[model samples]
Target: MCGIVGAVARRDIVPVLVEGLKRLEYRGYDSAGVAVLNGDIKRVRRVGRVAEMEAGVRAENLQGEIGIGHTRWATHGGVTEPNAHPHVSQGLIAVVHNGIIENHEEKRQYLRQLGYQFDSQTDTEVIAHLVHHYYLQNGDLFLAVQQVASELTGAYAIAVMAKDQPGVLACARMGCPLVVGLGEGEQFIASDISAILSVTRRFQFLEDGDVAEVRHDKIHIVDRNRQPVERKLHVSDLSLTSLELGSYSHFMQKEIHEQPKALADTIEPILEEGFSPALFGAAAAEVLPKVEGVLILACGTSYYAGMVARHWIESIAKLPCQIEIASEYRYSETFAKPNWLVVTISQSGETLDTMEALKFAFSLGHDKSLSICNVRESALPRASNLVFYTRAGAEIGVASTKAFTTQLVALFALAATLAKLKGQLSVDQEKQHLDALRLIPGSVQHALNLEPQIKLWAERFYSKHHALFLGRVLHYPIALEGALKLKEISYIHAEAYPAGELKHGPLALVDQDMPIVVIAPNDALLEKLKSNMQEVRARGGELFVFTDLDSHFTESEGVNVIRTPRHAGVLSPIVHAIPVQLLAYHTALQRGTDVDKPRNLAKSVTVE
Candidate 1:
């Protein structure tokens, strides 16, 4: 995920802009840059973290009253300083962009034909040039942005600064994320609240096709027709204070422990409303009758949440689901028919893969699509027929511990809503599911207590170079996610295969030096997991199993099983996700790796 932020303030806003960029560094750190306007244009950009950009600013004293900044996860170009964000056009129109511009090639070629030249190999460069092109035709900057947005077809959240329009920043979102924060004599625009939390509490969640002309004193909202629209303000309950990890060594570890509270922040709000989604009337009715099949389109942890959801949705709603990674859904020949209900899950909401998948599903004729995402104005939400916001606050860590769990909670709620709408779930069935959901946070808290021992096991495996994660059924997805977490952050070679498929190939890789992490929750698959652990032992592979206290899983010579609290088959996904995160965290810590900013990785995969 690339982070994009813009600020319009009465006084100098460069410092505040840089600070906002720092908070968003977790989203991406490959490159950073800012475009600012005082009486004139000033740009500071570098191909690294916020620290590098900050140092350049301090060493050079780049000042401006209005500005936009970006931390880039490079898409089309190499991670060079010049390729960093805030790409400036030939006519001096400046822009900071977060999603890929798929039509960049055709646009770039057309612009080149009109005697326009480019500086970097970025798809974003076309925006700066396009805005400059629009400025020549339309006298107004906001109108120019609207024109540019109309021409673009792919995902994007763009902030533009024009030299002619002093003290004002123009921003628009189609399939990317953007939020405008209301502050005293100042206004902030960011990809997420985390960037502006230290600056402002009041924010306007920008909807898709909505454009804003943000100035120090006021913000003007305009519809696609360039007609003035009323702004909607949503008060953020998240205190920026809680975003800090305090004494914890890493954000990932802090988030691992914060799951119980995070779940509360997300789940409790639904419970108070009676019906799921606070649905009472037409919204409920509209959502209920339109589904033929459920399609979950996501990437990474969200995909795992979808897998867990396939179990619940199938069990409760009797709906078959096909979960597709967002990246592949577009190019594949497969399709969703009309009336196919698509649910896309993403934390940033601007996740490129998820956004692309939604567009693809819609393009394939699926008219009804919904997004369950954390960021309000994110692209996935804007493109959907319905949007459910996850109140998980800001998950800063790239490894993704809590965000994954909150998504599961939301998916479970969606499934439950479908069950109610279908009239398949009786009141007791509804209560039972709700009760199971209610216990998740508490169970999650208890699961966090096992870290002391998990850390010990981490010590044993930190030196090992390879690992295997195995499980079946719902736990199989947990196993996949667990291995992915370890490999993503720890850089260890970890493979997750269905336990049933382990012997087909992966069993050959087992050895005394190999650490095997098995999702061994006490379910129907317990005996299968037990047998799998024994197989690992027979191969002299080290073992780690997530089990219940009553399950007789003693620490054998080659096996080490950590007992988790016994929970429902549906609820085990919540409990089982914790240890995997802890194990990865501890392993990364032991290796002295940068847990937050791992190499060759950005928090969000904004590009394909």
Candidate 2:
């Protein structure tokens, strides 16, 4: 995913644009650039982080009151300075864009036929040239952007500025996200609210196919059909302190510690009133009762959260559940049923795969839909009929921590609510579940206390080239998440298998140097997991077990044990997620890798 930020203000906007890009650094980018307009367009582009671009801007002393900035995540070309955004056409117009333009080749051919030479190997360059073509004919920046937007196909959010019109900035959204920030005597547009939070909190979220014309004093919006439209302006409650990494070495470590508050914020509201279908939404009373089964669509850590929910839904609610990786679900033929509830999960609700999958489910006559998301204003939650906000705040780390655990809390609450709706849970049973949910925040705090021990485990893990993670039944998804975190940040080769499946094929890879991590919860599968651990030990693999406080597992030769907080029944998955996160964070620290932004991995997967 890329980040875009633009501002129309009275003061010099170069500092504001650069600071906005710095705030959006967590979204991940390979190259960055900024274009400003005074009497003419002055721009700077760098083939690295935003800091590099800032250095270039400083060296050149670029200044303007109107400008657009971008941090590009290289979708169409190599991570080169020329491929970075703020693409200029005929030295008159500069454009910064996010999302793929599916028909760029056709537009590029037409523009080349018009004798417009290309400068970079990016689809976004087509946008600049195309707008220039339209601007030449229409002599209006807004009309030019409107015409170009109508011609472009595929998901895109773009902001364009012309040197001829220094005070006007035109932006549009097709399928990707864009927001307009309302400030006193100034206006701003950014792909994310966090990017402009330092300047303004009041925002208008642009809908699909909406185009906006921004000026220093006013903003005008229009729909796809060129009809004037008004969007509701929302004042956000997010604080600047939440985005700061105070006293924490990295964002991953800070978010790992924030899980206790994040989980409490997610589930405490529902626990206060006990379990109720209305906790999801007002329509949950009618919509959830008709559900025959569940189809969960998600990607990455959110998909793993769905996997954990599948266990809870099937065992506790006695319902059939299916989990689909959102990226793959759209291409497969599905037997869609109307009564089945389609659940989509994402931390940033702008995940394109999951968003497209939700649309696919809607087209299949699956109207009973729900979205579990962290961002309230994101597209997925706005599109779904019922929404559950995870309230995880801003998850800045590329590898998820608080967002993942908060999703588990939301999914567990969904499982319990569905169980109550299905008449499978009695009053006392619901009370028991609610009581356990209430204790989760404290349990998460106890798990946070284990970071010292996990840091010790990281010492042993940083040197290992490969690792194997093991879990059984309810904990298998957690094992998968653990391996993902370790590999994502530490750059260690890690894999996970159900403990029973180790003998099938994964056991063959076990050897003395391989570190085998086990999620040995004291559940019904503990004995079977112990047998699987014995299989690894027989082959001289050292075991690193994250087990329960009362699991009775002791440290011995060739094996080490780290006891987590006492298991909290259905909420064990949320608690167990903490140590693994710590293990990954500290291991990345040991390996001297960038823990917050891993190599080549963006925080949000906005592109395919």
Candidate 3:
């Protein structure tokens, strides 16, 4: 969860580098630095926000038309000036890196034996020293970087500049994101499209193990074997205005309010015609008929999205479905059947753990995998045999809001398609589900209307030290997502359990000081969930419930209720998540915490 920006332009690039880093700030970073070659390499690193780095650049009058910059989330070393990037090697080469070098210690010792000293306790500095080690022997910047990349182990996206290689930047990526921007008499490189969008949208996404050389007027890309590679330049249609905070106080608030539209976009394609298995891809029509079971792989919020889909798949499609946390799946000797349909869900499509799990699953004979992701051309989407683009747009907030709901929309569509293929749904039933899907946007708007009530309920959370969220069956994942949001932004210790599981252990932690959040959709399990809520109240636990309009529950002493529009039937999870998101947003706002870029977190987990 770091950012890298490099550019070679005919004019002063300091301002461009600063603004680029500003855009990448959403990715989350604790320090920022830049290096430029003006006859010699000059660099400035600060152990704070990009604004501080900008001030440092201006005060020091750091100017160069060619430079590389980084915004780092500390990994190998502590967050300090010396640990910041653009770390110079022998005062001749500067390198900025993202991701971890798993074998840096061995290389560090090897370099020390060769009379090379390290200034910062960083794996990145090893890359710099290793580059210098190779450059001294080969006298070629590109070959030196290639040699260093060959020697290093683990994930990294690095941009390098040498005094001898003025007006040029060499970059390489493995298990991290890197893109090259095309412009007139200039070229750019960045970790993501947002960083270089203001400069140029025409860009090429660098695949893992690809090395790039960006010059003022041209750019070259090569594979790990040093063979020339051709990658198409894509002109992104994302509006710069979409990245801005409009009337909303924070990006998290803005994103929370954008769920209606995001869900609408996700369902639009399936709604155009009735939902069908063929909507997934051309092979889905054939694959759906033979599919014996379902397997879902994902991490973080996307993993919770997969959990909600497990209920949808088993109950609706009547398929035996299993879910795995991506990080653990890779290390497990899990069984993967060839007939099972494996699905991977991610917002960025570059989640390292999920990507690795997908690869590992494929290696185990589960090659028929699909990716439900937001970003096009990202690693997960590109690697999948079939892809369902979520169309959630760019989710800038570190705490996901719109992305989670939109992923559920996609998953529900997949469920309906599978159910139809399995003869579990008739034509009439399919039409009804489509109509319900069509009404989701309106239902989400109604959920947003309850924010004022949710905000009022959130006032009690300003002093809360702990929270417990309760839901039953399908809604349990929503409960988990709500608890995660509370802990993420509000910094309150929170936990979620299936309402039935409370008495087993978590109920002991409940007291008047603990707030219990109940996602009480008016399903068959409502009565059971209500009984569980009563147990919390019996222990003097405060209750905040988000329920349907016709639910039997009501507001009273020690109980708060925010009524939603109506029960969404099978699509209730998508509707119920809105209030949960708003609850977290307003609680964070009330607590005066960073609502968008929560501390110690990044928007995209590009590294393990």
Alpha-carbon TM-score of each model against the true structure: 0.91, 0.99, 0.98
Q: What does candidate 3's lDDT look like per residue over 221-266, in tens digits?
A: 8898889998987999988988888898888888888888888888
TM-score quality measure for candidate 1: 0.91
What lDDT would candidate 1 get against the real structure?
0.83
Off by over 4 Å in 3: none
Candidate 3, overall lDDT?
0.89
Candidate 2 lands at a TM-score of: 0.99
Q: Write the per-residue lDDT of candidate 2 for residues 205-235, one digit (tens) a residue.
A: 9999999999988899999998999999899
For all candidates, the clash counts are 3, 0, 0
Screening candidate 1 with a backbone cut-off below 3 angstroms (N, C-alpha, C), the clashing residue pairs are 1-604, 1-605, 547-564
Report the lDDT tens digits of candidate 1 across residue range 1-608: 68988888777788888988888888788989988886567888997789999999988888888889999887789999778988888646899998888899999999999999888999899999999998889867888898998888777889998988887789997766688999998899998888888878898887768899888888998877778887678787777766787998778887888889889888886677644545322354676577867888888888999999999888888877788887888789986666768989888887777777777777777888788888766667767778777777777888888889988888888787887777778899878777887888888888888989999988987898989999888888899998998988889988899898877889999988888888887777788777777777888888887887667778867678788877555878888998898889999889888898887777766666
lDDT of all the models against the reference? 0.83, 0.91, 0.89
Positional deviation of 105 in candidate 3, in angstroms?
A: 0.6
**Ten-residue stretch with the least lDDT total in model 3:** 273-282
Candidate 1, residue 117: lDDT = 87
